[model samples]
Target: MKILVLSNMYPSPAHKTFGIFVKNQVEALKEAGHEVEVIGITNPLTGKKNVISKYLRWITETKMKLIFSGRKYDVIHAHYVFPTGLLALLFKKITGKPFVVTAHGGDIDRMAKKNPKIRQWTEKILQEASHVVAVGEALYQEINEDYQISKDKLSIINMGVNRDVFKAYPKKKIRRELQIPDGVEPVVFVGNIIREKGLSELVEAFKTVKEKRPQVELYLIGASRNQAYREELNQLMGTGVHFIEPLPQKELAKWMSAAEVFVLPSHIEGFGLVAVEAMSCHTPVIGTEVGGLRYLLRDGSGVLVPAQQSARLAEAIITVLENDDLKQQLIEKGEQKASENDEKKMIAKLERIYQQIS
Candidate 1:
């Protein structure tokens, strides 16, 4: 199969971590013996304010590349729904090509909700796609209901964990490199440092957890680009709270394996990919009950508390840490759950989707 990947989220020298899952999927496709090419709207990982200019760049780049390239692709795969996928739709109109759209949250959940015009436009794009891929069940259901997309046209396929990169590492060696004391129990949180990510609640919960277990340390690992929110989080960090800049995937896996527990206190998650990555390291995850976390952490695989409830999040974290039997149970089950969403399985499913559409 020959595939052309269209997205605004793909990684570049400027933004190494931007739309990394989409990059991973493209890599998996290539590894599976499919020829793939990508034409994306190149921009900074952050500080991208001119949406109109970005769309114009994407349109011009895609048009120039498609017209000049001699290769004819069997399918065009899009990462986001509204703009990038809409670009695919435009290409199809021009060249009569088939295209697939993968909704990675935000486009449907955030952008669609921005106004009625975008909502209608996005729905039209989804309706015209050859097929639609939803990263989570919640988003899948939302698209099905909001846009009235048929079941035959839609499928829920999460961006899977890369087991090779995310599997367990030597915790002691990682701790040594990170300078984390051996006796301390570190709880890790990896994501954007934003208010919507529940960093405030995590900080509050850590404060409560500290009162009970003084040995507990909070390790926040992510890009602290939101300076105002970073200041707020700094105010909440009294002691035993360490903040580190975003590490690459290899380094992040080491930290994930080194920590006693991983927490995802997001107010809303499209797929909770970080939780799956943590589970791939055999680390117990404690996530809030909202969005995709509800399904991902379901069935006792990990701990879940009400969203934005600091005390409840604190209680869940304390229970997982203090209870040896439960901690082990979560670890064992987490490994199993992570395996289900491994790259191999996800890639195979995507291959099947491509075959179906082709």
Candidate 2:
């Protein structure tokens, strides 16, 4: 099958960590024996648009790309609704192809709520689509509650972790390399530093956790998408809180293996990719109960706390830290569950989608 993979979410040369999910999906589709051509876009300014250019570029580049591509695609798979869905919708009208829409979280939750115009565009795309895919149940419900998309049109495809790459490593060696003390228990949070990521709340919780367990260390990984957010977090850095920018995907796996506890306090997440990656490395995760975490994390894997509740987050951290046997049990169980969501199986399901839509 010849597939045209459309995404306004993908990593760029400059910004490597931005929506690597689309990139991962594209590669998976190709590995499944589907001939895929990507029509992916990155923010030219990396999300600092002056408003006028943001709207104009969507029509100009996104719509224009489909019109002039010359080669037709059997399946048009659009990732995230904002610009990708809009462009895919326009192409569907022009070429009469089977369009598939994938809803990422912000589009269904925030953008759909704030912009009626974009919401209408997204609904038209979802309603008319041959199929829809969402990474999480929250996003699936968000789209279904507001739109008239049929039940048959939707499916869930988890973005899987590469287990071999994230498997267990020498934790003591890693800790020594990073100069972290043997006595300190490192609680690692891996994701972009943004408003919705809940890093500020993580810091607050860490402060309280420090009051009780002085040896408790907080490690903040990943790049800060917002300068102000980075600055706000800087005050807490190096005072039992260590800040590190985004590392290569390979290095991140090593870091995950080193940490005693993994925490993702994201207010919104389509799928907690990093959390699962940690689980694959036999690291116990503690994430917000909201979004895809509820579906991905069972009771055996880790603890789930309410969103934006730093106190509960802290309590959960402490609970895991105090219980050595529980931590080991969660790690053993999480590793077993994490192995179930493999790229090969996910790609196989995607192949079926391609064949059906084609």
Candidate 3:
């Protein structure tokens, strides 16, 4: 099948971890014998002027591609619902082809709530799409209840873990490769370093944990789009915290493997993909009981704490670090959970969806 993928978030040279799941999905589809073409926004710049110009250029490029590409695609798949789906909707209307849109959390939880106009557009986009994929079960329920999208048209399908790249490695070897010192328990977080990701809360929690276990170190690994927020976080976090830039998947997998525990304190997440990757690397996860994390970490798979509660977050971290039995149990269960969302299975499910719609 020939597929055209439209996504507003795609990895650039500078920000390779940004929207990396979308790139992985595209590559998986190609390996499965499907022809795929992508039109994505690769710039990781911020600021009002840059944002406006970036979208303007993206719109112009998408319009040209739809107009001039003589080879018709079997289906159009969009990542985000509002802005990116707008282009897929346009192509579908002009050519009478079916389109699918995957709602990756913020589009519904944040973007749709921004204004009445965007909310209305998001609803229309979901309504018009041939199928909709919600990356988490909570998102599936939200779209059904809040957006009034039919259950028949919506499915819960996470961007699964590539076990081949994320599998467990010897902790000592991985730590040495990454230059991580021995005798220090590293608690790692891999996502955008922003306020919404609960970085402030994580820093405060880590401070409490560090006092109890001086050997524990916190690693914040990802790009910081907001300069002011980054500065504020830097001020809040003193010694014992390492701010590393976003890394590619292979390197990130090594960090995950080397860590004592992986933490994701996001206020909202469509799906905690990083947590699953950590699980695949035999690293236990500690996440907030919000959004996808609630579903992902349920039933002894990983430790869960309330969002914004540094006290609870600190307690969970300490418990995981101190109790060897609990940590081992979490690792075993987390690996099971990760196996259920394997990339090969996910791509096959996606292939079936494309076939059904086309």
Candidate 4:
């Protein structure tokens, strides 16, 4: 099958972790004997002027590709529902090609609610697409309840954990390889370093934990898109907090493996993929009870605290660090959850969706 993938997010040298899951899916398709062509935004710079220029260029180039590409694609798959899906919808209208749009959280939870115009556009895209994939059960419910997209047209499918890249390693060995100092318990968070990701809350929570346990260190791993917000976080953050840039999957998995506990204190998440990756690395997860984290961390798979509650987050972190039994339980259950969402299984499901639609 020949597939054309349209995504507003894709990794580039400047932002290797940006939209990397989309790249992973494309690779999975190729590995499954499907020819995949991807058109996406590689730059993650976010000034207003830069955003406008990049989108314009992306749309123009995508239009040209749809017009002049010699080989006919079996299906068009879009990652985000609004702007990217608009292009897929255009191609479908012009050539009668079936298109599938995968809603990856922000497109629905944030982007669709940006304004009435965008909401209308998002609705049209979801309504017109041959199929829609919601990356989380919560997102699937949102589309169905808010947009009235039929259950037949919508499916819940997370971008699964690549166990080969995210499997467990000896924590001490990984720490040595990464040069992590001895006598420190590392609590890691891997995601955008923004306010919405609850970095401020994480910092505050870490401060409390640090007060009690001087050996505890917080490692924040991801890019910061907002300079002002980054500055704000820095002011709130004192010692014992380290900010690291985005890393490739292999290196990231090492960090996950070395961590005493992995935390995702996001105010909202479509699906906390990083938590699952941490689980695959045999680390316990602590996340807020919001979005998919509620579903992912259920049944003692991990610890959950309310969003933006630094006190609660601090307590949970301490509990995980101090309670060996609970930490082990979380690790065991988390691994089981991660296994259920294996990358190979997700790729098979995606391939089936493509075949069914095309």
Candidate 5:
């Protein structure tokens, strides 16, 4: 099988975290003996005032890349619905080949409503695609209901995890490198710092957690996309709550492995790939009970609190921290579930999809 992956999220050397899931899936397909090529995207924040220039640049760059190369492949696996999916749909029109699409939250959940024209394009392409991949059950439902896409065409395969990187690391060395005291209980929040991610609630919960255990430190490992929100968050942090930029993927696994608990208080998540990585490291996760998070924690690998409920988030964190037996149970269950997302399993499933579609 030959596959052409279309996504804006493919990781560049400058930003390894970006489009990593797309790269992982492509690798899985390739390891299954399929050939893979990528048409990665470039997303420039579209201003209400500058929408024309943004679209022109996007279309021009994409057209030149796809038209000039004229690559041949049996499978076109498009990661997002709008630009990537739309572009692939056009490529198919020109090349007369089949394609598959996977919607990873933002396209259907965020972009669809914000811009109706893009939504129309996405739906038309999805309606014509060979197959549709959903990251979780909620997203599966969301895609089906939103577009009236048939259940037969849809399947859920989560983003793969690198178990080798996420597994238990030398916590002492990682802590020393990050300059943290060993005795203090450290909890990490690792994602883009934004309101939708529920960072404010994490800060509030951390304050409550500190009230009970003063030695506890909250290490936030991300930056805000919205600068005004960054200013807003800056006001909430103090000596106990430390903010840092997102670490490299390899170093992040060490940080995840070192932490006592991994917290993701997002209001929405297509899939909690980071949470899976933490559990793979034998650390318990605490995530919001919204969107794809329910799918991630359904097996009791982690604890869930009502989204945006700072009090419950605080309580869940405290319980996971203070109760040793529960902590151990979560770790055991989480490690088991984490193995299910291994690259080998993901590759096998994707190979089946490629065969079926091609």
Candidate 6:
């Protein structure tokens, strides 16, 4: 089968970590014996939103590529529902190809709520697609509630963690490479440094944890290119609190291996991919009971706290860090859960979806 993968959220030479989940699925499809062609826009180092020029470039490129290319696609798989799916909808009209759109949170929750015009378009896109994919069950429910997409047309298939890159490593070796001090338990967070990720609340919670456990350290990974948010988090980056720029997947897995616990306090997440990766590294995770975390951290595999509640988050972190039995249990169960969502399983599910849609 041939697939045309469409999205604006693809990684480029400038920004390597951008929508890498979508890229992973594309690669998986290729490995599964499906031919795949990608048509998308890549952002600059700043990671800015699409402008008028970008929109024009994307549509024009899509038309030129599909028309000029000799190969015909069996399915058009688009990540993100609004504009990228909208473009796919246009291409479908032209080529008479069936398309599937994957809703990755922001489009359904944020953009749909911000403007009626986008909401209406997104509704049409969801309704018209041959099939839809939601990264999490919460988002799947939201899509059903909001747009009334039929059960047969939608499925929950999360982005998988690469076991090769995210598997466990020797903690001491990784800690030495990272230059983390001995005798200090590291609590880590890896994501965009933004408000919605609950960075402020995380800092507050860490402060509380610090009072209880003096030997622990906090490491904030990922890009801090958002100057205002970075500045806001500046005062808290002292003593045991550390900030590191975004590391590649292998490096991040080492950090996860070194960490005593991985904390994700995001108010909203399409899918908590990083938490799964951390779990795959035998690192127990403490995440907010919101969005994908509810599903990802199931069956006591990892600790989940209420979103934006610094006190609860702090308590959960402290409990995980202090209790050896609980930590070991979480690590053991988390590894099992992580294995269930491996790339092979996810790709197999996707192959079924593609067959259904095609």
RMSD of each: 1.7, 2.2, 1.0, 1.0, 2.2, 1.8
Give candidate 5 regions above 4 Å deviation.
42-58, 69-71
Predicted candidate 4 versus true structure: per-residue lDDT over 1-358, tens digit per residue: 9899999999988889889999988888898899899999998999899899989989998999988972399899999998899999989988889999999899888999999999999999999999999999899998999899999888988898889999999998889999899988999999998899999999999999999999999999999888899999989987999999999999999999999999999999998888999999999999999998899898988898999999999999999999999988998999899999998999888888888987
Question: Please, what are the lDDT tens digits per residue for candidate 5 over residues 263-319?
Answer: 999988998888988988888899988888997897688998999899999999999
Q: On a 0 to 1 TM-score scale, where does candidate 4 land against the true structure? A: 0.98
Better of 1 and 5 by TM-score: 1
TM-score of 6: 0.95
Per-residue lDDT tens digits for candidate 2, residues 83-171, read 67877777788888888888877778777778778778778778878889887777777666768666677888777776667787788
Candidate 5 whole-model C-alpha lDDT, 0 to 1:
0.82
Off by more than 4 A, model 6: 44-50
Model 4 scores a C-alpha lDDT of: 0.92
1-358: candidate 6 lDDT, tens digit per residue: 9899999878876677777778888888888898899987776334334466676788899878778762388889888998899878976888888899999998887988888898899999999899999989899999888789988889988888789889898889889888988888999999988889988899999889888889999999987657888998887655678888877788899999999999999999888988999999999999988888898887988998999999999999998887999999999999898898898898899889888877
* CA lDDT of every candidate: 0.87, 0.80, 0.93, 0.92, 0.82, 0.87
- Name the regions of candidate 4 deviating beyond 4 angstroms: none
What TM-score does each of the candidates earn? Answer: 0.95, 0.92, 0.98, 0.98, 0.93, 0.95
Q: Which has the better TM-score: candidate 2, or candidate 6?
A: 6
Point to the candidate with the largest lDDT.
Answer: 3
At residue 311, candidate 2 shows an lDDT of 97
* Clashing residue pair totals per candidate (backbone < 3 A): 0, 0, 0, 0, 2, 0
Q: Give the residue spans of candidate 1 off by over 4 A.
A: 45-53
Better of 2 and 4 by TM-score: 4
For the record, the alpha-carbon RMSD of candidate 3 to the native fold, in angstroms, is 1.0
